[model samples]
Target: MMEFFIQGVLHPLLMPAHLLLLLALGLLVGQQGVGALKPLCAVLLLSVLLACVSTLHWRLRLDLEVALLVCAMVTGVLAVLRLELPRWPLILLGILAGVLVGLDSAAPRIPGLRGHKIHMLLAGTVLSSTLIMLICALLALMLRHLLEGIVIRVLGAWIAAGAILVLALYLLRDRLA
Candidate 1:
């Protein structure tokens, strides 16, 4: 149980797609200034919680990785562009990213792990994911003044490029397999 919980906690940090989407969302929200933080965070939290709960009953049988990568790519591009988007769009993006993260972070079906144990695993994931998002957003906000926003843009570009590369490799691997 402890091991499963620990795995859940580390899921976002370990998964490339999850990490990228979180970072991209954080950076984009942070770039929008303090005003955008509350709404986006609220939306993200609600969406993630709902999606995680839904995963316990019926896991979506779709290419969630590809969807996550695409969301990350779009968010990264938005960050790089530094567009001053209105609050609604940012909130919408937050919701989308949160749901994807939650859906993809479902615990693997291991033998004998049932009921409360699975919930504990997902609880850890939710806690860690939320913390990571908050930390990333706060860090970006703090560094915004020091770097004249260049660092955020660079990170966003890197995230976008990385997503594209990974997506390509993932698709090719599927074909080859």
Candidate 2:
């Protein structure tokens, strides 16, 4: 039980796609300025909860990795550009990102991980993912003042490049195999 919970907590950090999406989304949100933080956070929390519950009940087998990478690429580009987007678009992106993260973070169908144990794992994942997003966003926000946002933009570009490479590799995986 404890082991599963720990695994759940580490899922987002361990998964490359998940971590990239979180970082890109966080930088994007941070670049949106302080005014957008609260609402985006709220939307992210709600969407993540709903997506996780839906995944648990429905067990949707969607190939969310590609979707997640696409999102990361878009967000990374947006961050690199540092566009001053309106509130609605940021909220929409937040919802999309939150849902993707939640869906992808679902516990694997391991034997013996039934009942409350599964719930425990999910709970830990949800908590850790949310906290990591918040922390990364806050870090980006702080760095904006210290470095005149250059560091953020550079990180965004790196993220975009990385996502593109990984996405290409993922798409060609079957061919490679």
Measured against the true structure, the TM-scores of the candidates, in listed sequence, are: 0.92, 0.93
Give lDDT tens digits, candidate 1, residues 1-177: 787678778988999999999888888888888888788878888888788988877897887999999999999999999988988888888889989999987667788865778887888888788777777888888876656799999989999999999999998996878
Candidate 2 overall lDDT versus native: 0.84
lDDT of 2 by residue, 119-154 (tens): 777777777777777887888888875567889999
- Those runs of model 1 whose alpha carbons end farther than 4 Å from true positions after fitting are 174-177
C-alpha displacement of 175 in model 1, angstroms? 5.3
Q: Give the number of colliding residue pairs in candidate 1.
A: 0
Q: Give candidate 2 misplaced runs (Cα > 4 Å).
A: 110-113
Best by lDDT: 1
**What are the Cα lDDT values of the candidates?**
0.86, 0.84
**Clashing residue pairs in candidate 1, if any?**
none
Local lDDT at 110 for model 2 = 75
TM-score, cand. 1 vs. native: 0.92
